[model samples]
Target: MREPYARYLQLLGFDQTPHGVEGLRQLVRRHVIRVPFENISKLLLIRRERRGRPTTLNEYLDGLERHDLGGTCYTSNPFFAELLRELGYDADLLGCDMTRVNVHTAMRVRVDGSAYHVDVGYGGPFYEPLLLTDSPHEMRQGPYRYVLDRARDGRLAMNVFTGEERVHGYLVNEIPREREFFTSIILDSFRPAATFMTQLCVFRYFEDHAVQLQNNVAVHYRAGESGETRISSMKEIREIFENQLRLPRCPVEKAIKTLEQLTGQDFFAMGEGDLYV
Candidate 1:
């Protein structure tokens, strides 16, 4: 495992031995703070997204391996556990069902008798792991601050303060690692009426902040200042492949054409888009 994850740890600036919860926290913080999540490596996989056959974790990793783009929470959380093991931290890879169409994978670490959710993956949900406690907290970083309040209803509610103001945003539930996790997320995603109200989003939570990417928008929220940047375009999604994410010449045209065909709209038109990212 050490040999396999050596390159990744080095890439994430965790090439040293990182023991205990603080170490794990630092490791995750480094990953999310550095890596920018993107999907342009579809060309490297050369496998098109087919109906009922979304790209799995293995495929995404393979795509990243081929293109040098790497992965976000979906692949990185499990990889984080591998590194923690090398550092002698008790960690495990757990799968949580967040929605019907999305099954999120994360790392659970127990260090110094306290458990923390270390997920540097899942770009739209969290950025680092959260201490599983019922509390209101703010994660503050330079020029960004994101807030989370555990609702009385036991729902993990959050809002991305986009500098200008607050907006109705993400709703998260911390599902346990269960055998039915995969199926549950699928059931939630495809239910008769889904209410996520965002694009196909993923998240990573830190102690006080979370980082997420919804479609082409990248949001960094902690506790003080916040940064929201338009990282992609619904109209120019094809260009995103060619520019920001850097996809192959083939997949760019293919994804755009597929999106266009599905929505009966121009692929480069931002005015017309779907909730799914």
Candidate 2:
């Protein structure tokens, strides 16, 4: 394996390169548990550089090593697909639609003659690959239940439900997308009107539960129950990042400061609804 890819595997806690379906499952599970899905790094970069772009493999790995940083879908999924290809899996970058067209990125990997939907970047707990087939595939993590099924238009729909309510969803386009296709969308995300630029949101998944921070509110979900706590200050936010997520202190402080400067409001005082598109 190449040096960077080797380091990626090491960070994911793998002793060797994984192979086949079970290997793919292990990779996906380990990745979501270890690497979070957050836009804090993006916020810092946009403040420093005055522009937003996806991270290169080296930059992504470096951020993880230095700051415990993981990125949004644009950075996480494409780089993960690249790693899968480096490991000799037939993985393709796929586009997803929420409120807009091709606004999200995911992966489709063919492992031992079966195609599986693998996404580590949705800021949700996707603990395993969802097999792409005519039949619906379902899994539950914490208080949320995820269902992947074919839509009437032949596209796959990934839906997240809490109890009887469908809270989140996206339509997946099976057509293979080149990396360049998402450059414009990724850049657009840094715009002032974009959701991530306007509010604070972060997610971290564990084996039994997941933690989500949207603006001033933090929700901890596990199995049949969830608890909510209101954050009153940036210091509280930093505590959550350090204590719950185990992120490094320097980048967390830098990211929070940049967020306040960019949005012109206290990070914890902002309103909610940043978690969904």
Candidate 3:
């Protein structure tokens, strides 16, 4: 394996030896908690060039090292699948429909002849490799619960819920797709009105809690507790990114500036109603 990628696996707290399914679980779990799901790079790229580029794997890993940042499905999932392959795992790249047309990337690993669904992006739908079974399987992590079901289209459907309310539905495509297939969507996400570019959405999932930052508001919560949401200052926001989220210092500063330009609000004087989760 390459040095930087090897060091990245170690950064996620893995040993020098290859771990089987257990290692995959550890990688999936730690990747989310350590690398934030944010679009600061896209935001920065668009801010300067008014367009996007193909997000390369090295760029994604370098962002994690240089800026402590994470990319969307396009960057995160493909890199993860590559990591698994480099480490000698049978990993299959998969794509899904999160929106009507937009695609979300994930992967499936056939370990010991059993296939498991693995997603290290789009937050914490699967902190572990979920057994690909026709029967419904529900897994809970921190404050949220997700139900996995096989759809009629031969894909897997992951239903995200909090308590009794269904929050989101993701339908995994039955047919697997390659990483390069998602290049267009990656560029599309950086368009002026795209969600990842315009919104300051940051998510970090842990075993104990999940933290989210949308626009200027930050929410931290766990299961059984009403999450706390408050309008945050630039200083406080930086602290959250660096401390709570474990992101590097530089990119976050740039992210703040880009956000101010996008929202036309002063973070220093912002109030509660200025943002949302």
**Clashing pairs in model 3?**
143-223
RMSD of each: 6.4, 1.7, 3.1
Q: What is the lDDT of residue 111 in candidate 2?
A: 84
Rate residue 67 of model 2 by lDDT. 79
Q: What is candidate 3's CA lDDT for residue 129?
A: 79
The stretch of ten residues in a row with the least summed lDDT in candidate 2 is: 245-254
* Winning model by lDDT: 2
Q: Flag the better candidate by TM-score, 2 or 3.
A: 2
- In TM-score terms, which candidate is top? 2
> What's each prediction's TM-score?
0.58, 0.94, 0.86
Q: What lDDT tens digits, residue by residue, belong to model 3 across residues 1-277? A: 7866787787677777567778777777778777777767777776777678877777777777777678767778888888888888888888788755447878888888888888877765466777786458887654567888877887688877778987776888756677878888776776656666556677777777777776667767677453655655667777777776666454766766786687676744444331212
lDDT of 2 at 76: 88
Superposed model 2: Cα runs more than 4 Å off = 141-143
Q: How many backbone collisions does model 1 have?
A: 40
Residue-level error in angstroms, candidate 2, position 127: 0.7
For candidate 3, which ten residues in a row score worst on lDDT?
A: 268-277
